[model samples]
Target: MTTLPQFALTVLGLLFCAGDVAALALLLTWQERAPSPDARRLRLLRGVLPASALLLALLLLAVVQLALL
Candidate 1:
């Protein structure tokens, strides 16, 4: 019952989510090894990025689902 556009949108959303996760993973690993004094800023980013990405991806998927309906 799924159309091509719907399928594509789902894939896009998953990819976006995966990309954000990968980028965050890379940042975490790199930051851990690097000597940095801005640990507080990193902690703030660690809190913010994933939540924002999840919200945006969910919003995109919601819009796509509404379009299909």
Candidate 2:
């Protein structure tokens, strides 16, 4: 199979990085001070965010920047 063009790959990497940053921010700051009614949902998100960040990290790292030849 043909590889994606360099620009497409770079875009994918940026998206992954953005998602990871957003998740990291939510995990660190947004949930700390908010007093919401749905404690159960908040707990669920706490569990989910770390895993999502890890996945995004892996995806972002897998984008090899090999086009600078």
- Model 2 scores worst on lDDT over the 10 consecutive residues at 60-69
Tens digits of per-residue lDDT for model 2 on 1-69?
Answer: 335575676677677767767766676565555576476468548765666668666755655442341
TM-score for all predictions?
0.50, 0.45
Predicted structure with the largest lDDT when compared to the true one: 1
Worst 10 residues of 1 by lDDT: 28-37
Q: Count steric clashes of candidate 2.
A: 0
How big is the RMSD of model 1? 5.2
lDDT of all predictions: 0.65, 0.62
Name the regions of candidate 2 deviating beyond 4 angstroms.
1-4, 34-69
In model 1, where do residues sit more than 4 Å from their true spots?
Answer: 36-69
